[model samples]
Target: MMKLSMLCCPLLLALPLLAQAIDAGPASPQQQETEGWLLLQSRNLAASPQPQTATPTERELALQRWLKKYRYEIPDFYDPDAGGKVEVKK
Candidate 1:
């Protein structure tokens, strides 16, 4: 019984190693399609132009309107630039 247990123990340990050796080759068709879709999406995202966002002046004006609507007192230190000259780089 002792000798049988020793032999069986090694065989049981080797079974998992043998299972891992079996290769399931290439990815499935669904997996390949999913990968291709992801690649296309990434490429499209890279190629697309950035959406138009609010400028500093527009943001400031929005904030001023919000403050007025809420009836919140503007702090004395809060100096807003109303139509300030913005330097544009050539």
Candidate 2:
């Protein structure tokens, strides 16, 4: 019938698009965050690397002093058992 053919024609054309939309739904928050970090890292890597210096610059020294004076100590509690237990020497 012409009506059945017309109805199926539009649906056949749209089925693939509907399937794509369902399959490629919105990215998860963590996936989006990881993608953002990956983009940032790629940009940083693409830039020319700065030369390392034996001595700190005045700006670096000043920043270090400020951090030493005001920065709160970050607790080092991440992956405490990562490498298994270490034997302590007396």
Candidate 3:
């Protein structure tokens, strides 16, 4: 009984590690944001490769507004207009 318990203990401890080993592959930006708080759980239900468009959360929207208004002279990704596609409506 002691031997059986020891063997089972190792298998149980390894179970979560084995789960993490499965290839989730690459995740897209949209898939990274989700209704669930955890991205990992959401990614499991997400259709891979193709990304679904996700609406920005309130906090994200606020951050974008702040960056656009107070970015000073810094350029590139921090400057939304650098992409020539960001249209932030006032």
Count of clashes, each model: 0, 0, 0
Write the residue-wise lDDT of candidate 1 on 4-46 in tens digits: 9999999999998887554564378887788877888987854
lDDT of 2 by residue, 1-87 (tens): 999999999999998888644456337988878887788888886454777555568778878888896676666787766669889
TM-scores for candidates 1 onward, in order: 0.38, 0.29, 0.24
lDDT measured at residue 27 in model 1 versus the true structure, 0 to 100 = 73
TM-score winner between 1 and 2, please give it.
Answer: 1
Candidate 3 lDDT, tens digit per residue, 16-79? Answer: 8887564574466665554343665666754567876656797798789888977676555575
lDDT of 1 at 82: 55
The lDDT, on a scale of 0 to 1, for candidate 1 is 0.80
What are the lDDT figures for the candidates, one per model?
Answer: 0.80, 0.76, 0.70
Task: Report the error of model 3 at residue 70, Å.
Answer: 43
